[model samples]
Target: MKSIRIDRNRRLRDDPGTGHNRWHPDIEPLIEVAPGEEVLLETRDAADGQVKPHMTFADLAKNDKKVGHPLTGPVFVKGAEPGDILEVEFVDMTPQPYGWTVIRPGVGFLREVFDAEFLAHWHVDGKFARSPQIPGVRIPEGIFMGTAGVAPSHEQMRSWNARETELVSRGGLALLPDPQDAIPASQPIASEGLRTMPPRENGGNADIKQLTRGSKLQLPVSVSGALFSTGDAHYAQGDSECCITAIEMGATAVVRFNLLKGEAVRRKTRFPRFSHPGYFAAPEWAAPHNFVATTGFPIREDGTQECEDLTLAARNAVLEMIALLGERGFSREQAYVICSLAVDLRISNVVDLPNVCVSALLPEAIFER
Candidate 1:
């Protein structure tokens, strides 16, 4: 049982499938680790070395591939058999001395509205990143990986597709059968390409905020050794990640892996959900709001009703704002898109509301701060 320490300066390559970049921990010349052991990797930011402190927008224009989101590895887990679950526990994410986030004209969730290159840089002069928006809002600097996951059970998937394209659901590890299995296990399971941001069973681009430090993620093991890789580090991101990118940055991660065999796991394609037993905290326009969050699980098989109802409830909550915006002349489509992109749906006050007053946070940076 040996340990591997992968450094941040290791050479990385672009992942053609995801249009993101990555590195394999096991193949690194400087680090070596055996199965059932652990590895520590010092990672780089999302710009993949393209953006460094003191580098200007002109420098960013010089690099063909902006290399900020560099993934650490396709670390091979020795003896990890199919039908097993690889448990990855995130230990710590200490931010580099600095980080950056940009809003490009043609990119981001609101590209149509803000069609201009907007770059924001933050350096940890001491303890926080100064916020340009609110002179009083200073954020404690923290680093967390934005993208992390294992190889697909079958062939590599295409970028821009959802993580669920060829693999299982989001968050949970995949369970890939060996090629020797009667079902021809190595074949790609689905035809969908890869997802742009959301996480899938193959665990790519999962932007779940709870995947932070002190959380355990279980991935299904499909092939021998479970070729696992992780990348897409973020400094801080709000829920729904309305911005195309978080405070994208690199990170060093200490990961511990364990195997679970034949456990009865649930297979659902919905986004990950969490529960707060007592009262939970949420932001309010005028006051601090507390609510008991609860969700209504739709009985319909297709989930159309559930999605529709959830969308309507979201609209209703902002009816006054919508009317005001419309009165000021914003179109219905624009208002709807605003809600869709900026709003986050959560179970709220399940015990009190008739249909479970699902809480939707609308672009509040309160959580990130």
Candidate 2:
């Protein structure tokens, strides 16, 4: 099996040749392999080791946001080309000992309300992740990569930039291309590379927990050789990742690649599709036997309602869960992190116009009482 290893004690910046922090077609592949070849890749944490177990919120201010989601490899898969489908089979994942969840300012779904910075340091074992900061709570292991994707073609990159730039001009929340702290920090690649925050046609940062071991993710290929990279492993995460983080950690992921010639074009696939043969999480957690749920609607706090707004409904659902946790003696920050790590948001009803209902379900089994 082919592999790429990195020094865990050092940041990705210290050895930029092994990985990259941005997505650009021109960034050369770290290695090339034939189709159906299996590869093992060791990856850095999402924050590139800037957030440590001993660190507090004070350290967050000094973090370099540009270095977020430092991916391990743009492994070139031979025979994969534009209009083909690249199937990534996640064979296994080995989680590191330490993991963390954070609530940073100007990030997450509830960024406006939970503006304060908070951190939860976890001791991750084989089966569960227990946090010293969150007393009496234990999150079950559901290891998976948080970000994985292929290099976008030059035309795709330019088109994406243009659309995002237009969104920014209209007061949308989009991170534009910035070369500062960028890996492979050379020439136009640094200035034009796409950020790793959102999922696009190339499938970066989908954060789907269901893509665990035995799962296969099919991505629409847009570039030759399908230069694929992956990183930002998570020990566990809620569906919404409401607080914008899970049990974030560095991990070694074992994956194999397969190609479906002309399948993407034949199916008109524009987004990633994934499937898992078995349960993605612990049996009890996957379909929780005991749970508490909160329901929310599009109606705002001021008695006004938006027209079929699922986003507002989800926000309200999570806020309600936070309030419920507060009644159980958890601080707002603690509750937010808990929601991020354990809560599952489901749309109960979307056909109900002007009042789409969303439910936030908290599995009671996670509490170690």
Candidate 3:
């Protein structure tokens, strides 16, 4: 029944942080609370509050991109430990009055297609996010935290970073910079923050738009006290998140924490799960501009993609979307815009290779009714 104020005492690794994009057990808890309590959580934008209302891509490019997605906790829940389920119910999430999206060179699903730098700004009111920058576009309010997680144990950090290092060494990752080159000699490798780019077991940037208010996110505790923190607020986002950026904004949420134990303490390869209880109406899910899309992988019972790639998965989904648009007699540009604004792309499963399906829930509603 206590409140944790979101302030300076919560800062950790990254620029304003002690180091890089990592969360470690050593970072000291900013506040402590027992399970089954509510706290009003405040957060900065994914760019760590760097891009202002009047700022342009040039302004953002000058500022350090490393320090953003500034998370706001390490909130120690009394009696929480590893193998426990940390359930966070987002009672509410409210975005700020402004937001922006950036498409930088060498980033996004279609990076090769559009290699230049682009920025778009939006005016976010209490209800909708509209852009004068992109006339005739209005996005509905479905604000959610793009990143949230508890700290991993030291062993987890080494294993995670080591795997990434292995990938870089094997040239499996082309865009990722070498970690060794990025981290200084003085900082402890285990102490640095985990990269906030990809989704991991500890849940950094899991950008599922369905995880809005009324959604409960269950994460496995790798470290004691379940040092939970969150940032990367998005006012709205398509499923593919193809552009590498969403409508980023600073926001606040009232989170109610609960501990799930017994058989509920399961970790899906370290990835967390988001669920909405009860049969609540989801008009948006089937709205005209939207339709439940299925991405076909057609993998054999015993086959593999042979590559660690979501880009390829996105390609399949986009191709499916293009086909869907063709059915409606829409052009490529029309389909692309609809995908940007309405399509919610989600990986159905990557485990079942050959047919690792990716679903692009098409918002048929994107087209005129």
Candidate 4:
């Protein structure tokens, strides 16, 4: 098996359509690899290595477009045939000695209320940071690449948020079936093309907090040569990722690839498990919630079942406020948007019952505070 290291040497000038600036990886085209081969990638942080010790918010404001989440690669996996799964096991991500997390104006869950941009800088004494908010809170700092995925399967597929303005010109397949499964089989399926901001079946910007260390992401191979890329390395982010940015910092990631051919797996599963033997302190603010799982059965063009018991399970915890608010006073649409801004989505159990159980947790404070 051959191993390659990928990096992003330049910044992307194109608009990511999310009103944020994005950077593409500056690396050679990916070299194809046989099954079981691995690629170790050295990923950059969201700033594209621009943040400095003496930098101020003025520096950030000047380059606001270039400061948001950035990603690397369009690495083409060799011999990776369609109908296969590309497994990315994150071996390690080492953060720089310093990092920054900022909340920008008109961005984040509290965007309308808190319109001013706030910056929180930190110095990593060890693998952690002393919380700049409160004295006792210890911040476990680790690098997590925010944006990572392959290119679309077809030409017409624009970035996720660009659908309304751009016509579906050429071939483009929606990874997620709409209310109905009306996607075409012959069309190219780029999992990244489905969701507007991360968190798709192909695992684009799944800002899951649990993806910190020792997590494995398994993405389906839609087109040949699973084009894999990763960037937007964050140091620490809350569950909801309510803020537009996390502790944005530079990162070096080692990725190992494994091919799962003809394996029976659910559409969504908790990222591969990591075992930490040492005991760790749980944040006082953290609370547990029940798990709710839903299965999406593939429907034929005629609305009949194509395969029996073949279901995709999505696990998410509904916030009591959002659920109760919708049930009582607020409209479902309003409640859903509130939940999207406040609720946290996570994978609970991949091997449970007939379907996998994904967890979505809601912080009680969002409602109380």
Best by TM-score: 2
Error of 3 at 323 (Å): 10
In order of appearance, the predictions have TM-scores of 0.61, 0.97, 0.79, 0.58
What TM-score quantifies how close candidate 2 is to the native fold?
0.97
Give RMSD to native, each candidate.
9.7, 1.2, 5.5, 11.6
Candidate 2 colliding pairs: none
- Candidate 2 has an lDDT of 0.91
Q: Write model 3 residue lDDT over 85-196, tens digit each, in one string.
A: 8888888887888888777887767666556566778897656687655555567776889988888888887788788878889877522323332322235532354666
Q: Residues 1-369, candidate 4, lDDT per residue (tens digit)?
A: 343443334433332211112212122344555555555555556665566667666677655342334444555666665566677667667776666666667665546544555555666777565434323234555456676665444422444436532433445432232211111111222222243244444456766555545666667665666667676776666555655666666666666667676331444432332222221333322333432322233343355543323222221133333456555455433344334333444555555444444444544433321
Error of 1 at 319 (Å): 13
Whole-model lDDT values for every prediction:
0.48, 0.91, 0.68, 0.49
Kindly indicate the candidate among 1 and 2 with the higher lDDT: 2
lDDT of 4 at 301: 33
Query: Model 1: per-residue lDDT, tens digit, 216-330?
Result: 6777665566666566666555454543655666666777676666431434322223222221232231122432121333323344444335434533444433344356454
The CA root-mean-square deviation of candidate 4, after full C-alpha superposition on the true structure, stands at 11.6
Sorted by lDDT (best first), the order is 2, 3, 4, 1
Q: Tens digits of per-residue lDDT for model 2 on 25-129?
A: 999998898888899999999999888878887888888878988999899999999999999999999999998998888889998897777889999766899
